[model samples]
Target: MIGPATPEGTLFEGRVHHMSIERLLAFSGGPFTLNHWPARNLHIDPEKAAEAGFPAPVASGLQAQGHIIRLLIDLLGDAWSRTGSFHSRFRRPVFAGDSIQAKARLAARRAEAGVTQYTFDVWCERHDGEIAVVGTAACTVHEPNPGVQAA
Candidate 1:
């Protein structure tokens, strides 16, 4: 089942399908271990990250994207896996202890062949409210988009 569509010209449009995630991976801001590639220019290794100009070990961008995928799926439905797409930009590094929240707002919608495609403004924000990642998400489903003109 698809989620509700945000109507144009309404304040509740964005909230109709609102979603939030408190924390993901929620680890203490400390050193991590990866046997295969120890301190080899990766986020899990502080020394390598420092050498690469990063203050500390940084989480993987894919990890952040995974959170987004979950948010989009929850906002839409299980059907998202088949037609969902994401365009993301890594804006900041996620430290080990920094909490991450996934948030999304409905952006636009349109109809195609038979499925409706919905676009969303999505991002991963740190606990401090800084955006660590920003992107747009699209999910195509069979549900009709109410209060939206399929263009």
Candidate 2:
């Protein structure tokens, strides 16, 4: 059986990491969504979404990004916060009440001098298996733990 991922796992090419937003956990940013803060918007009000042509409120793209970041942190620990960079494109609308999963596969890992660089192909998949977001993320570490070399 596979074990939980940890920084000590020697992050290797092809390893996978993930996080999820269950159907029960989907949320509207609401007050935090300053554009429509505390008021009706495409993200917090279904009626507003209909006005704009969508059937229901859509979650922010950044929310999906947040889940991907959480997966990275779980897999890479603090190294992700200090040196990670991410770029993403929203492919399909993530509507309210949808269940989605943010997944990452380590696509590259290299070490030279005192630096170790890691890259991942990341995506968010809707419950029905359609991709909702896609991106690449990378992190660089200086003088990483000797035990953490890529396997």
| TM-score of each candidate structure, all chains considered together | 0.68, 0.72
lDDT of 2 at 145: 44
lDDT: which candidate is best? Answer: 2
Cα deviation of 48 in candidate 2 (Å)?
0.9
Clashing residue pairs found in predicted model 1: 29-97
Which candidate leads in TM-score? Answer: 2
Superposed Cα deviation of residue 98, candidate 1 (Å): 0.5
Cα RMSD to the true fold for all candidates: 7.3, 6.3
lDDT for model 1, please.
0.62
Q: Model 2 segments beyond 4 Å from truth?
A: 1-37, 143-151
- Model 2, 1-151: lDDT tens digits are 1112233223222222222323212344444546744555677677888999998777777776777887777656667778889999989987777777777777776777867787888888877788888999888766544223223
Each model's C-alpha lDDT?
0.62, 0.66
**Per-residue C-alpha lDDT of model 1 across residues 48-106, encoded as one tens digit per residue:** 67888887667777776677777676556655667788899999877656777777777
Worst 10 residues of 2 by lDDT: 1-10
